[model samples]
Target chain A: MSVVYGRVALIGLGLIASSMAWGMRRAGLAEEIVGTARSAQTRETAREIGLCDRVVDTAAEAVKDADLVVLAVPVGVMGAVAEEIGPHLKQGATVSDVGSVKRAVIAAVGPHIPDGVNFIPAHPLAGTEHSGPRSGFAELFDNRFCLLVPAENSDRQAVDRLRAYWEGLGANVEEMDADHHDLVLAVTSHAPHLIAYTMVGVADDLRRVTDSEVIKYSAAGFRDFTRIAASDPTMWRDVFLTNKDATLEILGRFTEELFALQRAIRTGDGDMLFDYFTRTRAIRRSIIDAGQDTDAPDFGRSKVHP
Target chain B: MSVVYGRVALIGLGLIASSMAWGMRRAGLAEEIVGTARSAQTRETAREIGLCDRVVDTAAEAVKDADLVVLAVPVGVMGAVAEEIGPHLKQGATVSDVGSVKRAVIAAVGPHIPDGVNFIPAHPLAGTEHSGPRSGFAELFDNRFCLLVPAENSDRQAVDRLRAYWEGLGANVEEMDADHHDLVLAVTSHAPHLIAYTMVGVADDLRRVTDSEVIKYSAAGFRDFTRIAASDPTMWRDVFLTNKDATLEILGRFTEELFALQRAIRTGDGDMLFDYFTRTRAIRRSIIDAGQDTDAPDFGRSKVHP
Candidate 1:
C-alpha cells in the first residue's frame, strides 16, 4: 500500500490513537506519524514503545506541517485541543476527529479549522474494556464499523480520502449524519455501558453478599457486566456528558421495560417473562448472523479447572 | 476416578443434566447413567447423542433401583417430578437437584423423598446461553462452582460421595444454606439476567434504531447483554417466579443505584460518574484474579475483519 498522507499527527496517545498509529504503520497508510499527549508519563511511554515515528511535547508542534491532524483526545477536550492547534495546521490539510459523540465534536472543533483545511468527523465503533497506549494493537479496528460524519459543506475528496485511510486500517467505513450517529450509538453503546456500571455498583453495595463471593461466582453473568463497567472512567464520563439527551432517552425506555418485567415477576406472570426472553433470544441470533459476535458457548471462554 | 455409584438417574436431559452425564462418563464417576426428558424430541436427541447409557421414558423408570437421583428440570416442575419418582427411589439412595434457586427446590422436592433416602439440593453456578442435550460437553463444569445445600441430619457419607463425584468432574464444591444461596444467586445471576433482558427489550422496541442497525453496532456493549438475555426462557421464567423475593430485593437496589447514576448524568456530574465507574473497575480485577473469568481483551473474541 502507498502512503495516503505525507505526515499524520495524533493529538492524544491513548488506545484509539495508538491503535491507529500501529495499524497505519502496518499497512503503510502514512509516510510519517507523530503523536503528543498531555501527560508527560504517557508521552514517555509512547516514545519508549515506538508508538509513532516521532513524539512531540505539544499538540501544536505535532500538527505543524502535517497532512492529517487527528484530534484523539477525550470529548471534553477536543475543542480546546483544536483551538490550540488551529494556528499551526498546515494549509489544505485534512482535520478529523475520533470522538465517540459526533455533534458535540463538530460543534467544538468545526469553527477553529482554517478556510483551506477540510474537517471530517469519524468514530470507530470498536473497543475493549482495556484503555491506555499500552493496550492498543494493530488489529483493534479490523472488521469494525467506522462511521464518518462529514459536515454538509465539507470537501468530497477529503471525506473519500479519510474513508480510504480507515479502509486501509481494515475498518468498514460508512457515512452518517451526526444526530443519527448519536442516537444509534446511544442505543448500542452509551446506555448499555451505564446500565452495566449501575448493576456492578449495586452488587458492590450489597452487604449481605461479600465482595469475594461476588468475584468468585462471577461466571454466572455478573462478570460480563463487570467487564463493561471496567472501561476507562474518563472516556465514559465524557461520553455521557457529551451525548446527554440520547443516553437519557434510551435509559428512560430501559427503565420502563425493567418496571414491566419487575411487575411480571411480582405477579408470577410466567407467560410474559417467557415471551419477552424468547423475543430477546432472536436478537442474539441476528447479531451472531451479522458477524458482530461469535456463536460459541460463553463467548468461548477458557476452561481452567482448579 | 473409580465409579462412586452403581447407577445414577438424571430426571431431565438439558444442559446441566447432559453435561453431568458426559462429565461423569469422562471420569467414570458412575457405573451406569440413566436419563429421561419430558419432550420426545429431547429424549431422541439424548439417545442420539448418547448422553446417557439408558434413555428411559418416565422419571420413575429412570429412578428405579438407582443409587443416585438428580432432578435437573426447571424449578416450577421440580415438585411434580419429585412426586413422580419418590415411590420408585431405591432405599438408601441420595436425591439431589441442579436448580438455580435452592430454597424453593428444597421446599418443593424435600417432602416427597422416602424416609430412608437422603435429600440434598445443589445449584451449579455455571451454564451457557445454549440449551438442550446437544449443547452439553464434558468440560462444561471445569473450574466452576457447585453449591450444595443439605438438610439438617443429612447423611454425611452421601454428601461426601456427591462432593467427590463433582470434584472428579472438575468443579470446586462448597456448602451453603438454602436461603443464603438464594440471596447470593439473586445478587450474582438472577438480577443481572433480568436487567440484561430489559435492556435488550428496550433496544428492540425502539423505532428509531432498526433491528439491523442494533445488531450491526452491538459489539460495543449491547451484545453482551443480548448473550445473557438469550438464555433459555422456560428456565429463567421459573427462576424469577420461584425466587421472587430475593430477585425483587436485588432489583430494587439496582433501580435505586441506577437512579442515582441517571441523575448524575442529567446534571453533568462527571466526577460522580467517574468515581462510581472507577470503583466498579476494581471488582473486575478481582474476578480475573479469582480465575472466574479471563482478562484477555474483548473476552478473547474472534476477529472477523471484513
Candidate 2:
C-alpha cells in the first residue's frame, strides 16, 4: 500500500495514539511516525517500545516537517499542545485530533491553526477497558467506526485524505457534524460510562457487602460495570467536563427512565417491566445482527485466557 | 464419583434446572434424574435432548421417589410448585431451589414442606443471558458460587449433603442466612441489572438517536448493558418484584452516589470525577485478582463466533 502521509506526528503516547501508530504501520499508511508525550516517562517508554519511528521530547519537534499531526492528548490540554505546536506545523499540513468531545476540541484548538493548515477532528468508536502504551494492539480499529467531524470551512480534499488514512488503518469512516457527534456519543458512550462508574462507586461504598464479596460475586452483571469504570480516569474526567451539556441531558433521560422502572418495581407492575426488558432484548439482537458485537453466550467472555 | 442421591427430581426444567441435571450427570452424582415442566413443549424438548433419565408428565410423578427435588422455577411460582409436589415428596427427602431471591423463595416454599422433608434453598450466582432447556450446559456452574441459604432448624446433614451435591456439580458452595443473601445479591446482581436495563431503555427511548445508530455505535459501552439487559425478562421481573426492599435500598444508595457524581460533572469538578473513577478502577483490579473475571482484553469477548 502507498503511504497516505509522508510523515505522521502523534502527540500523545496513550492507548489510542499507540494503537493508531501500530495500525498505520500494519497497513503502511505512514512513511514515518513520530510521537511525543508530555511526561518524560511516557516518552521514554514509547521510545523503548518502538511505538513510533522517532519519539520526540516536545510536541513542537514532533509536528515539524510532518504532513499529518494528530493531537491525541487529553481534551483538557489539547489547546495548550495546539498552541505549542501551531507555529511549528508545516504549511499546507493537515492537523487532526482524536478527542472524544469534538465541540470542545474545536473550540480549544481551532483558533491556533495556521490559515494554510486544514484542521479536522475525528473519534474512533473502539477501545478496550485497558489503556496505556503497552496496552495497544494493531487490530484495535478493525471493523470499528471512526467518525470524522469536518469543520464547515474545511477542505473537501483534506477531509477525503483523512478518511482515506483512517480507512487504510482498517477503520470504517463516516462523517458527522460536531453537535450530533457529541449528542450521539453522550447517548452511546458518555452517559453509560458515568453510570457504570456510579454503580461501581455505590458498590464500593456499601458496608454490608465487603469489597471482596462484591468482587467475588461480580461475574453476574457487576463485572461489566467494573470494566467500564476502570477506564482511564483522566480521560473520562475530561470527557464529562468538556461534553457536559450532552452528557447531562442524556443522563437526565436515564434518571427519569430509571425512576419509572423503580416505581414499577415498587408497585409490582410486572407487565411493564417485562415489556421494557423484552423490547431492550430485541435491541441486543439488532446489535449482534449489525455485526457490532458477538452473539456468543455470555458475550463470549471466557473464564480464562490462555 | 459416587452417586450422591439415589433419585433426583428437577421441577421447572429451565436453564438452571437443566444445567443442574447435566452437571449431576457429568459427575455421576445422581443415579436417576427425573424432570418435569409446566409447559408440555419444554418437557418434549427435555425428552428430545435426553435432559433426564425420565421426563415425567407431572411434578408429583417427578418427585414420587426422589431423594433430592430441586425446584428450579421463577421466584414467583415457587410456592405453587412446592404445594403441588409437597404431598408426593418422599419421607426424609431433601428439597432445594435455584431461585434468585432467597427470602421470597423461602417465604413461598417453606410452608408446603412435609414435616420430615428438609427445605433448604440455594441460589447459584451464575448464568448466561440465554434461557430455556436448550441453553443448559454442564460447564455453566464450574468455578461459580452456589450460595445455600439454610432454613432455621434445618438438618445439618441435609445441608452438608446438598453442599456436596453442588460441589460435585463443579461449584463452590457457601451458606448464608436468607436476609443476608438477599441483601448481598441486591448489591451485586439485582441493582446492577436494573441499572443496565434502565440505560438500555433510555437509549431505546431516545427519538433523536435512531435505533440503528444506537446498535451500530454500541461497541463503546452500551453494548455491555444490552448484553445484561437481554436476560430473561420473566426471571428479572420476578427478581425485582420479590427482592424489592434490598434492591430499592441499593438503588437508593446508587442514586445518591450518581447524583453526587452528576453534580460534580455539572460543577466542572474534574478532581472529584477523576478521584471517583480512580477509586472504582482499583475495584476492577480487585475483581480480576479474585478470579471472578478474566483480565483478558475486552473481557475476552470474541469478535466472531462460529
Candidate 3:
C-alpha cells in the first residue's frame, strides 16, 4: 500500500507549491498539507482556496510536525525561508525545493537544514508564463520530467519517498548534480528568457514604433518572445541572481554567436545565414520527435487535460 | 461597392503569396488571380493546392494583362521578377511586393519598373513557420496589418487602388516610407528572428548539452524560438541579405542591452534584474491590449487564445 506523508509542509504558496499541494490532495498522496507564507493575506487566501489542509500564520507553526517540507519560493528567498523553518522541522523529515537554479538554492538552504533531514533539491520542468497561487494547475506535471539533485550523504529512503510523491502526480523522475542542473537550465531556459525579455524591452522602448504596432506586427516573430518574457518577474529575477555564473557563461556564448550572425547580416553572407537557419530547423524537428509537444493543431483537440 | 482589380498577378508562390491568394479568393476581391514561380515543382504544387486561378510558368505571362502585380519572392529575387514583369505590365498597373525588407526591395525592383507602372511596395506582417502553398489560409490577413511603402513620387490613384485591394482582402492598410518600413521591421521582426536563430544554433552546436534534454526542457523558454527558426531558410536568408544595414544597427542595440543584463546577472544584481523584468512585462501587457495576441497564446486553438 502506498503511504501518504503524514504532515507535509509547503513554505511558499506560489505556483509550483500550490500546484504540488493540489496534486497531493488530488492523488491522496499526503494525509495533511500545511502551508505558510510571509504575508497574512496569502495564508488566508491559501485557506480559502483549499491550497492546504492548514494555513499556519507562522513558518514554525507550519513545519512543526511535518514529515516533508518543500520550499517553492524564489531561489534568492530560499535561504531566508530555510532559516525561518529550520528549528521547527520534525526530526528525520525530508526537505526539498523546486527552485530553477539548484546550486545556489542548495548552497543557501543547505546549511540551515538540520543534520538528520534529507535536503534533496529538485526542479519540475513544467510551467506556464503565469505565476502565483491561482495560476497553478494539478495537471501541470503531466508528462513532464522532475530533476532531482540529492546530496551524496542524503538518506536513500528519503529520496525514494519524494520520488514516489512526484510520480503519483504524473512526473518522470531523473537525478543529476546541482551544478549540471544549473548549467542545463541556464542554456535551455534562463538565457533564452533573458534574450526574449531584452528584445521585448527594446521593442517597447522604441518611440518611433508604437507598442500597438509592435504587438500587431508581432505575428512575424515578436509574440513568441513576449510570451516567454511574460514569465514571473520575481522568479526570473531570483534565477538570474542565483545562477549568475552559468547564466553569464551561456550569455557570453550567446552574444558571441549573435555577433557572428550580425556580422553575416552586415556583410550579406546568405550562405552563412542559410546554414545557421538550416541547422536550427532540425532541432525543432528533434524536439517534436521527442514527444515534448504535439505540433499538430492540424487535427482536432488533442487533450484538454492541462 | 469596392471594385476588384481587373486582374491580379502574383509572382512567386511562397507563403505570403499563397496566403494572399487564399485571402483574396475568400474575400472575393480579385477578379482573377494569376501566379508564377521559377520552379516547375512549385507551380505544380500551387496548381494542385488550388492556390490561384491560373499558375503560369513565366512572370511576364502572369502579368501580361494584369491591373496589379504582387512580387512575393525572396527579396534577392525581386529585381529579376520585376524586370521580367515590367515589360508585360499594362499601363496604369500597380506593382507591389511582400518582402520583409522594404528599402532594398524597392531599390532592387525600382529600376526595372516601366515608367507608367505604379510600384507600390507593401509587406503583410504575417506568416507561419511553415512555407509553400499548402500552408496558406484565408483568415491569415483577417486581423493582420499590411504596410504599404510608396515613394513620394508615386501616383496617388495607384496607391489608393492597391490599398483598396488589400483592404478588400480584410487587411488594415498603413502607408509608410520604404526607409521607415525597413527600419521598423529591422527592429521588430528581422533582428528578433536573427537572435532567435542564433540562440537555437548555439544550443545545437553545444556538445556538453544533449539535444533531447534541450527539447525535453524547452517549455522553460526555448520552444518559442523554434517557431521563428522554423521559417523558410531561403526567405530569411534573403531578408538578412537585403536588410543588412538596418538589421545590424538594431543588432548592435540588442547586443549592448544583452551585455548590460549579463553584467547584472554576473554581479548578482537582483534589484536591477527585477526592475528590468518588471519593465519588460508591461510591454507584453500593452501588446496584449493591442490585440496582437492574447496574454497566453497568440495563435488560434492555442490555450491562451480565448
- Model 2 score (lDDT): 0.90
Candidate 1 interface RMSD to the true structure: 3.8
**Candidate 1 runs further than 4 Å off:** A297-306, B297-306
| lDDT, residue A170, model 3 | 75
Expressed as tens digits, the lDDT of each residue in B1-306 for candidate 1 is 899899999999998998899899889999999999999999999999778999999999999899999999999999999999999999999999999998888888888998999998888887888899887778878889999898788999999998988888878999999888999899999999999999999999999999999998887789899999999999999999999999999999999998999999999999999999999999998888887777664342222111
Residues A196-238 of candidate 1 have per-residue lDDT tens digits of 9999999899999999889888878888899999999999999
RMSD of 3: 2.6
Best by DockQ: 2
Per residue, candidate 3 scores C-alpha lDDT tens digits across A153-262 of: 87898898989988987788989998888888988899999999999888887787777768767767887788789888999999988888888888889988987887
Please report, as a residue range, the 10-residue window in candidate 1 chain B with the lowest summed lDDT.
Answer: B297-306
- Tell me each candidate's RMSD, in Å, in order: 2.9, 2.0, 2.6
Q: What TM-score would candidate 3 get against the native?
A: 0.94
- In candidate 1, position A122 carries an lDDT of 96
Per-residue lDDT of B129-214 in model 3, one digit per residue for the tens?
77777777776776678999889998998888888888887778999887778878887799889989988988887788888778
Question: lDDT of all the models against the reference?
Answer: 0.90, 0.90, 0.83
Tens-digit per-residue lDDT, B1-306, candidate 2: 779999999999888888888889889999999999999999999999999999989999999989999998888999999999999999999999999999889888999999999999998988878889988888778888999999779999999999999999988999999999898899889999999999999998899989999988887889899999999999999999999999999999999998998899999999999999999999999998887777675452222123
